[model samples]
Target: MRQDHASCNISVGSADLDLDGYGNIMAQSQQIFDCGEPLALDIDEKILLHGTSWKNANSIVCEGFDNRMCQNAFYGAGVYFACAACKSHQYTCNQHKKCCSCKCQRTVIIARVALGDSYVATETRKKERRPPVRSGSSGTYDSIVVKPGLIKGHHKPNQVHQEYVIFDREQAYPAFVVEYTL
Candidate 1:
């Protein structure tokens, strides 16, 4: 984690970029991430490694490619290279007798490689299931309510969780964002 108390300079790489032609730009230097390895960063300060995007920006916001999901889900320091293919399913049910409801669910795989050896990363997706319950079912239950009855119901939610070793930089990517360190 980098500190916000000081300002540091970093380099941006414009892939096949020209002084006149604008293209996807990313951080080019490995030094930034290398120095951030030992620092303990808060959630907000992590932005130094992760770039940002704006709806108004014409070019790719995070990586050279325009991925709204990836741009909005920026974390750690690196660029999104590729994503795995996925499919989705929708189901309609009536359990509460209040009304009919439908849900659309899908699973997607995303990958990012940070610059430098100061960090290591692995992406994971977890799927959770809950058994349907009667109308009186209460307590801490996560599920889409269905028509009031004994009908068993299930819902699938896809979540992305990533773990990184901050102090280790054997397989990290170059850092683009920089902040002053002690």
Candidate 2:
């Protein structure tokens, strides 16, 4: 629950958290108006994990995810989560060298992600900036899924492990911050 990293001079801004929470609430509320009635709970919502440096983890919990800050866009310019802990653990590198003497403790966030409709991705979509627009529809796919399987004629899969990505920040809620040492 404690999302702040005081030693790194990073504190969760109440306004930031409140504003993001409010926006998500409003978005969900609008669905009722758009559909003219309340809808059933989304089946795609999932509990997923995301790993990052301790500093970045604080920012994500406080300000919410900003895909623009994504360093790797292998799947797309979106926030990445994984069903497998080891997949997310690949990203828990300490980028803030000066902030920590030893990078023993790693951080991973447990998030509630609304993965609504997912599009399975091909290696060709590696540079995609966002989810592909749905065929013959104005709305885009809600998320992207990259699985571990070789494309025909290819030697290996573009990804070794599965990854899930959501382009919209509101689709994810940082529910827990877990710190552990390997």
Candidate 3:
């Protein structure tokens, strides 16, 4: 198991983002390990980032990712993750005005995502509820991978950042909570 700490600066675009704090999500390791075993003995997992509101981040850390909470299902109705921290940063929210006068900090969850058998999404599938069925097989793809520049849609430009989506909630384990300020 790899242990991550938020002691270094993260470069997003030209800006260097200094983390306010980084801590483990707590109590998710065994669950993540158990969930990946049936998918593959090797466990094809990737450490990805997911950005959301501070309130939602707390909920996720406790209850895990709920695909129904996904507001934008551009790639599919699932929890979305980004390979680049900058891409995930775009979704972070500063919703602290009503609660306190302190500078609102943005939150991003660094997760272990099990992308067992990924299908590259060549086109926009906004209405797709899950990964499409394999062309010549009865089994459906385990996850979706949308590479940069493949999609053209009204809501999104030719996607400039890579994204991964998993329909099963257990497929992702929130590993770390990183807080930062712009």
lDDT of each: 0.22, 0.64, 0.67
TM-score of each: 0.16, 0.68, 0.71
lDDT of 1: 0.22
Superposed model 3: Cα runs more than 4 Å off? 1-41, 94-103, 152-157
lDDT of 2 by residue, 1-182 (tens): 11112223332221101121224432343343232433223425556678887888899989997788876456768898876666677777685422243547888887776676677776645577889976644456777876665533334644456677898898788877889877
Model 2 regions lying over 4 Å from their true place: 1-43, 95-103, 151-158
Model 2 worst lDDT window (10 residues): 11-20
lDDT of 1 at 60: 33
- Write one digit per residue (lDDT tens) for candidate 3, span 1-182: 11111122211111111121123322223245343444232335666779877788999999999999876568778999875666777777565322233455878898877776677777878888888876655556677877766476636666666788999898898877889876
How far in Å is the alpha carbon of 18 misplaced in model 2?
33
Q: After best superposition, candidate 2 residue 38: deviation in angstroms?
A: 16
Q: What lDDT score is found at residue 118 in candidate 1? A: 22
